[model samples]
Target: MPRGRGNRRQQDPIGGREQLPQWVRKEAQQPQRVVRNLRRRPPADADEEAPLEKRRRVDERQLVAMHPDVDFQKLLGGCDRLYKSKDLREPITIDILIRLNAALRHVCSSRYETIMFQTALNLAFAAFLRVSEFALSSNVIHEHVLHRRDVYIDHVKNQLFVTIKFSKTDQKGRSTTLVVDKNESNEICPLHSLKAFLQIRPGNDGPVLNKGL
Candidate 1:
């Protein structure tokens, strides 16, 4: 019987069925390659876990075998100590604030700047205000920022009322009023400093410490 093209068997140059074409071998190996890759890949949960979380799990497992009296949190306090030891911030005292005001008098370019700095320093110290409470983030003014309208001076009572609309502690926007009284010293008194700044301050509605004013 004569063999047709479709009935003929195709063989490699080596004349062996085992030695097939490169594409045919590749196609046959693809399933095995995929299986090997799947075996090497980590589980989804393991991949998502952080190094700290992994360390915590290991510690927890070790803790299960340890004594009940062992305080893990107390042991972790060492890390906090190491972090705090590197911190550079120091507590600001009254003496430091006074010295800073004196330095500003010489360093400030103009009387406007001097008064502004002095007022801000004293007010922040007296009111225990964060930088965000009394100062704008940038040149742009926001509705939540302390404005001229927020300040009310009671000359009769000799007190200054400053309304803080937004604060870290008060996220709900429930406003809080700070009452600043006159001090014996004219230099560091928040009320006196504020009054001095207001005298030269422009009669415009904006942030209390704005340079544009």
Candidate 2:
């Protein structure tokens, strides 16, 4: 019995239990820390998007004014040639052209004539010169304006010819040569000449050339 009691006392264990108290005491003694982080603001570019986007959109007048290369005076000058001699000399200026354009706009039947004036100022003078070949159409006087190439073409060929496209017929995918030559060499008819001249005229108030004008 004494030996049994002595063995029981020796086998008793409290080492593992002692660790729990140490762990609890360490946890209670530790201080809690509060951490703070600074967040960066969003990029400054995001705030500027509205005004930047607004500036990208332009109105009609703004767009027109933006085209610095277009000459309104020269265009008016070309169109001025379509009128009678006395009227044609009225100075091929933008002011006169705008007035004439405005006046022509009122006449429904005169739509194409207004277009012719616009074309003179907007298109190359060589193009407007083609109108003279057609008798039915008003004569585009040489003094007001003349396209360089068209005049060159006339000088080179010694015949009147105008630049025009002919996709409807055999000249199929390419620009068809219209003969304005009085010599009747492969040139286009009077109607075609008129059509070609009118087709290339400028629709807006723009500059072209003063050539003879």
TM-scores, in order shown? 0.59, 0.20
Q: All candidates' lDDT scores?
A: 0.81, 0.41
Local accuracy of candidate 1 as per-residue lDDT tens digits, 12-92 = 657566444556657887854233366564544556666656566676658856657877778779778877666678877
Using alpha carbons, what is the TM-score of model 1? 0.59
Tens-digit lDDT track of model 2 for 9-84: 2322655332334445588889854334337433445445666666667764675688767775677688887663
Give the clash count for each candidate: 0, 16
lDDT of 2: 0.41
Runs off by more than 4 Å, candidate 1: 1-86, 139-141
